[model samples]
Target: TIEMKADKTLSSVLSARAFNALMMVDFWNPIYSWRRAVLMQYVPGTASFDPESSRYDLEDAFITNVKKSGLYTQGDRESLEIQFISLLEVELEQHQKRIQAYLNHARDRLKTSEGLLGCLTLAESRR
Candidate 1:
């Protein structure tokens, strides 16, 4: 009969709750989100870019920081513009829809206020 012997060591490490706490910060103002359409739609007229610098500097600041970090790179200037154009298009479309809705609401409010003012003016004239 041949005798066989084996030796082995096993270990395991598990971390169910190990975590790091981080504060979430958003650098954009709520009001700027509404007006960003104007900024994003164009790269601007006073841009300074050449062998000294690159074009993305002037236009890139307006993109939300998250998107800027995700989509931007030193080499992808044209791609950045294309992506900005698409994002700007979407933002502008949504802005237009919101503006239309606001205009409609304003029209309704104006009509109601005018009617009330007319009623008050007529009532005053009767006195």
Candidate 2:
């Protein structure tokens, strides 16, 4: 899991682009089959993990910290969440387009090489 700030600054964009490029390569030959991503705007306050307690408690603590940050009000939280979802959807669409373009280029190169090889074989046969 890669964690990054979603502020969309220059550094953030570069980091995301690098990560996306890595993911594209990994998609073809995966070192791991599954990739889980989490994007959050604000850093959460530190909390202690309790093996005895349920996961819900830990999650609640994190959420509480997010609210305490005062970056988003209740209404703003819903709007921001929707915006983030939209951003992710657009990013996925763009990534798919990039993958398709790469595949098409590779296929075209393969076809051209095969055609050239076939012509050479035909010339040799004629000789």
Candidate 3:
């Protein structure tokens, strides 16, 4: 079913150059989604929305791009922002959990190494 849909979408952009152009559009769509997801979490607490600040600039650009997409024109800006932030909260929480797990793993490895060193020191003393 997906392959059939891809074929239908491909007909309009038949040549390699045309397909390349289409691919760029396809690639940025997910990138934009990811940017929106990340910015939604951080932008609200930021002190400055000035262009000089990279985070603010990114947030502004994402909002501007979404506006031009014409999909959420019916919703108020605040509503849209809240919706996006809530939509990705679970994903953000899961990301934090993953980072914590990695840290715990590192700590565990350090403890194991310390124990091995203690045992080696005892063996050397006995010898």
Q: Quick one: best lDDT, which candidate?
A: 2
RMSD for each of the candidates: 23.4, 15.3, 18.8
Model 1 lDDT at residue 97? 66
Candidate 3 residue 89 Cα shift, in angstroms, is 7.4
55-114 per-residue lDDT for model 3 (tens digits): 223334444444444444556555444344234334445545655786676567558878
Q: Each candidate's TM vs. the true structure?
A: 0.29, 0.27, 0.24
Model 3 TM-score relative to the real fold? 0.24
TM-score of 2: 0.27
The order by descending TM-score is: 1, 2, 3
Better candidate number, 1 or 2, judged by lDDT = 2
Model 3 alpha-carbon drift over 4 Å, by segment: 1-57, 60-90, 114-127
Off by over 4 Å in 2: 1-22, 25-28, 31-90, 114-127
Number of clashing pairs, model 2? 0
Highest TM-score: which candidate? 1
Reference-based lDDT, each prediction: 0.36, 0.45, 0.42
